[model samples]
Each structure stands twice: as C-alpha cells, then as structure tokens.
Target: MDGIEDGAQPKKKKGMVMTIAAIAIVSVVGAGGGWFLGGMLAPEPLSSDEARVLEEAKATIKAREAAEAAHEAAPAGGEHGDAKKDDKDGLPKASTEANGVLQLDPITTNLSYPTENWIRLELALLFQGKPDVAMAEQIHDDVAAYLRTVSLQQIEGPRGFQYLRDDIQERVDLRSEGRVTNVIFRTFVVQ
Candidate 1:
C-alpha cells in the first residue's frame, strides 16, 4: 500500500509539470500571433506617386513663403514717389509743398539724486505736406513744458519714458491733424 501511494504522488507531480509547460507554450504562441497581426494591419508605406505629390506641395509652400517675404521687404511706391521725384528734378512745381522734419533738443527736467535725472525726450518731426510749421513748433514747446511740470517720481522708469513718447505723438497728431505722419527721435539721452 505504501509503495502504491509513492508511485501515485510522482504521477501527480508529472501531470502538474506538463500543465505548466502547456500554458507557457500557449502564451508564447498567442504573443507571437498578436505581434504578426499588428504589423500586417499597420499603415502602408508611401507610394512613388504620393511621394512626388508631397514634394511638389512642399515646394509650392516654400515658394509662397519666399514671395510673401519679398513683398514685405520691398513695398510698392504709389503717387507719393512720382511727385517727390519731380520736385527734386526742379520741374514746374504746382504746389509749394515740401517735406520737412524738426528735431528737438533733449532737456533734463527732474533731478532725483547726484547722477539720476528725469530726461525729457523730443522727437524729430517730419511731414510731406506744408502744413502749419508754427503749430508743430508749438507742439514741441508744449511737450517740453509738460515734462518740466512733472515730478521726478513720475518720470523715473522706462514706463514713464514710453508714456511720454506716446503722449507726445498723440498730442502732436491731434494738433496737426493727419498731415504729420511720422515722428522720429534724433537723440535720446538720460543721465
């Protein structure tokens, strides 16, 4: 009876080993099959014709970008150029209109310490038409007066300077209507 029991134990262990081996084989085969199917179902590679079309599309996009850049770099001249050129040539001038620019000197308005001071900036004014020159001069004078009135604390930082520039532009524009199109700063000194 004892010998029979031992023999039955060995048979049970062999059966368990065979079951584990079978499970491992099945898992490996399933993993391989899944990988093969995924590869087969993936997107196909680009054909020759598709490749050519994509290349042509990229070229077209590049050409359009280059053309836009060139257009921006070189703006087309309109009626303004012909008149200015004719005026330069000393032809029969119909109008006494001429382009003019005005530059203002930098003035120290506020002193904060031994070295720091709030500087008042004046921009060079330019115009194509012969508008009121006296009014333009008055605008600069008023800006200088306004800056002189402001405290050192008010015009100490970059924000204050930017505000002054914008304010000056707005005031000048309001005084000159649309005749004065541009205001350029010829000199800016802050010390």
Candidate 2:
C-alpha cells in the first residue's frame, strides 16, 4: 500500500508539470502570432511623392498664416489700398481665376413641386485653358434655371444627388461647348 501511494503521487506531479508546460507554450505561441499579425497589418509609410506633397502643403499653410499675421499687424493703407478695402469680409480670397477656376455666386431657388422648399448651391467651373468669367456666369444662370425646374424628390438621397450632379455636368458641358472641363459642386443646402 505504501509503494502504491508513492507511485500515484509521482504520476500526479508529472501530469501537473506537463499541463503547466503546455499552457506556457500555448501562451508564448499566441502572443507571438498576435505580434506578427499586428506588424503585418500595420500601415506602410507614405511614399516619396505623398510626403513631398504633404510637406509642400504644410509650407504653403505656414506662409499663408505668416502673411495673414503680417497683414493684421500692419496699417490698413497700402499700394493696393482699394483692393484691401474691397475685401469687405476680411477673408483672404484665393486667386481662383489664375488657376483657371471660377467660383460662381450661390444660387438660391425654390423647388418646382414644393415651392416652399428652397435650395442653395455653390459651384466652381474649371476651364480647359483660360477661365471665361462670362461663360461661367452663363452656366451659373443655366444651373439656377435648371434647379428651378427640379423637384425636391429629385435631389434627396445619394443616388438622386449623383443624378443631379450628372445632369448639371451635362448642362455645363453643352453650355460651354467643351471648354469647361469640370463642374465642382462646393455646397448644396436645402431648407
């Protein structure tokens, strides 16, 4: 009976040790696999072109901030006194015309079916070469007219909005006679 008891105790100890060792091995393997997967799924570093563009954008923003600060610190009078005074909103406006882009004034109109519901849209026209302010104004008028004919249901959901965009693009293309390359919708609000 003594020999049987001793043998049983040794077998139990060995089984316990084996179970502990198995658990430790599994934990280590699990941790390593998780680490490997994390590394594999990590986002790659930005490419050279993307990094360059980001840096350039940052520099441009910094320069703009410096210019704005300098402008605020200096007296209102300058060589372009009228130009400075004409900026009634005190907002620095980008020279869109220089980049062949013409932003039209906001168009506010009522929907055809529901006359009470109104829509305000702001758009920018990109020209193939030099931007024609005259043509842009014409397109703006055309868009306003087209909006007046559109019902609220025609511009409700995402699909409707896409169709609206396509319709506006087609109208602008026809009106500009292929000179206008793109119609960028900046803002669209309904009330």
For all candidates in order, the CA lDDT equals 0.64, 0.83
Off by over 4 Å in 2: 1-94
Cα distance off (Å), candidate 1, residue 115: 12
Q: In candidate 2, which residue pairs clash?
A: none
The candidate scoring highest on lDDT is 2
TM-score of 1: 0.39
Q: What TM-score fits each model?
A: 0.39, 0.54
State the RMSD for candidate 1.
Answer: 22.2
> Can you give the lDDT of residue 143 in candidate 1?
71
How many clashes (backbone N, Cα, C below 3 Å) per candidate? Answer: 0, 0
Cα lDDT tens digits, model 2, 52-125, are 87688668757966876787677666565445342323433345555677778778788996675678898989
